[model samples]
Target: MQRIRAFRARSTPDRPAPLRRAAAPAVAALALLLPATLSGCAAFGGERSGIVVTTNILGDITRSVVGDEADVTVLMQPNANPHSFGVSAQQAAELEEAELLVYNGLGLEEGVLRNVEAAEQAGTPSLEVAAGIDPLDFAEGESAGQPDPHFWTDPVRTGEAVDLIADAIVEQVGGIDEDRVRASADEYRGEVEALHAEAEERFAALPEERRKLVTDHHVFGYLADRYGFEVIGAVVPSGTTLASPSSADLKSLSDAVRDAGVPAVFADSAQPDRLTRVMAEEADLEIEVVPLFTESLTGEDGDAPTYLDMARYNTGAIADALAE
Candidate 1:
């Protein structure tokens, strides 16, 4: 039997401060003031109304589909972990007032899901992108049977999401030309298809033995299933970044890494690579730690500023790490 020793949880960069009882009155005052201020801005043409997206990846996709018809406001910052990123009170209010709210559902956005639910209850039309796709279940451990929310890893599935998001934008958002939205979506779909083809070609070039992945977390299941790669194990055994890895989990993964002779362990660009480094050292192997844009997009000057760029960058990184 493996001994499971709990590791201390690391603080996420975007973790918000705790609400205090004494500050409740000030918070309530700000809550009341924000709407009126936002309303005034809208009246003065300072605020652009359109789609409000919870995650940066979905925000980029929505931007591609909408194409300046309406402004798209993304709540999460570039390279922030979606599972832990929280929105501001003003952003939450914007979610309520936006023409449509788009989120990567299936419990991926743990911190912001409550705001999404509130927006829905307030009668703002919303779309859960993962709800339209055939989601994969957790194949093992404590989160078994829950739907995997990282469907965007699969380009074909992401293309499906493009169509679904386009349709929703056309139907729900007023003042946008439906024909233009459809046309934009069609063009983007072709791009997605091309991306998928490129990825397939790159992945096919790798030898069968090299198509194995060990990662910081279980984030690549969809990509592995789509590209013929095997995810032997992850440093964190669960889908979400919020889950902590036990010492036994790390030891087991290290043993697997040694047995499989994996050349590299991949970590998300938005996350700390400490666990993966430790795992590699513990395995007593000369394994490299590669960073990939697995979850969120980055700043405009960054490598993965868009959905297409993110996929291309990730695919290339994976191939280079494994093929070498």
Candidate 2:
């Protein structure tokens, strides 16, 4: 895990108190310019607003729970990979002004953690939806040892995240009528459970020959564990984009793919599939490259744009490809 220092919005950069003595007059004047009320956090936008989420996945879940009752803004956007993000001054201001904040945890948002700390210091209450779900062990060998943060690969765990999200929203918003939030979250949870049951039935129908999964990245450990799929290998041998696979690692992955007779490698729609294509070609086998909505949902108009919609869409895709 990357270590990040804490920050307070608008606070002077830390320096020795000796230098501070010379600047006491300026510091006192600066303090009085922005009154305490403006410096501290209070009800955002109005006395009674709803939520502001930090990641795209948490943002979607928050929408499901808040419905139309609360205004929402996702700090990260679709097609933006969290691994390569850096926060700006404007966004820090946004966090300071927000009512409530939510983020996906388990070290998934390492790049944005500094900004998150800043938000917390500014008194914006933030909740991590992936708080209680079991994260997958990194199974792509020793070098792939980062903790797997992709819990939503399994619907059961995703349902757990949704439950936490509902609780946080209700906690933050006081009594803004949780009936809609509760009903919606419960309804979605039921759908996820039903989807899992259906996927089990379909996987059971497949001949054992087609139960192996290959992928461009070391994603889907949760899905494999939940549904009895054998995870043969991946082109990039790490649990996250921050790491790269070695030449020997690639050779080993190719050998494993060939030995297992795996037909295709699946990649996330939000990610490019070039590495999967290269792996397929090097393996000298007819490996299909398929994309699915795994990391982030599609744009609102596109298919699988919502969390509930992605649950149904991914279920159909996996069943279609893996079922015998």
Candidate 3:
């Protein structure tokens, strides 16, 4: 039996007090130069009047579909864990005022879900990208039977999301060229579809017995379902990274890993690889811990700055690791 972290919260980086102090004088000076409302907005996160997306991956897709049609504001920073990232007061205000609020629904953005709900209540034209696509539930985990919100793992579904987001932008956002939006979406969708084909070809070369995955968590279910891979186990046997694994969970996963003989355990790049390393040792087998950009995108300098890049990178990494 696996024990789950019912109330665990993932730790996030905190700003130093010295930095805050340094910024205070600049903020005060800027406040004096701006109007009261705008000053308040600047204090939080700057007001965004255009499309506001919760996750960076969805933000990238939205930007592709929008293509200079409108301003797109992404709340989640690069390489930040979606399960634990939060919004500032001004960003929350911006969500309510957004022309279109795009988010990954079905509980992926655990920290800002209430803000999304509030934005919905405030009548912000919203689109839940994950739910629109056919979402799958956890087959086995503490979150079993709940809809998996990581549908973006499957490029096919992400292509579908492009269409949905484009349609919403055309219907909801005011003063935008619908034709341009549609055209941009079509172009981006083609790229995403191409990514799916690339992934299929890349993964097809692996032997059937090697098409098994053990990960930091149950984040690759959609990818596994799409690519015919089996997710034998995960270090954290839950859908969200916020959940922690107990001694029984580690032992159970290690036992499964030993039995399955998978060559690698994939950990999210946004997360620390400590637990994954521990699990590998517990397996008592020489297993490699491969870091994958599973939950978030990285900065421009990083390997996975875009959705297409992220998928391609993960596909190659998994294939290479398993082949060895």
Best by the TM-score measure: 3
Give each model a TM-score. Answer: 0.84, 0.80, 0.85
**lDDT (10s digit) by residue, model 3, range 69-110:** 889999999999999999999999998788778888778899
Clashes counted in candidate 1 amount to 0
lDDT (0-100) at residue 115 of candidate 2? 77
Model 1 Cα lDDT, one tens digit per residue, 196-291: 999999999999999998888888889999988888998989988888899999999999999999999999987899998999999998999999
Model 2: residues >4 Å from true position, as ranges? 1-49, 142-146
- Candidate 3 local lDDT, residue 189: 98
Stretches of candidate 1 above 4 Å error?
A: 1-49
Q: Give the count of colliding residue pairs in each prediction.
A: 0, 0, 0
Q: lDDT per model, in order?
A: 0.79, 0.67, 0.81
Best by lDDT: 3
lDDT of 2 by residue, 1-324 (tens): 221111233423221011101123554354344322122233544643446677777788778777886788887777667666656787767765566667775567778877766766555656655545655567766435445678787888888877877766666665467888899889878877887787677777868788898876777888889888898977777666666778787788888888988776787787878767777787899877777777777787878777767766776676677652
Model 3 residue 108 CA deviation (Å) reads 0.5
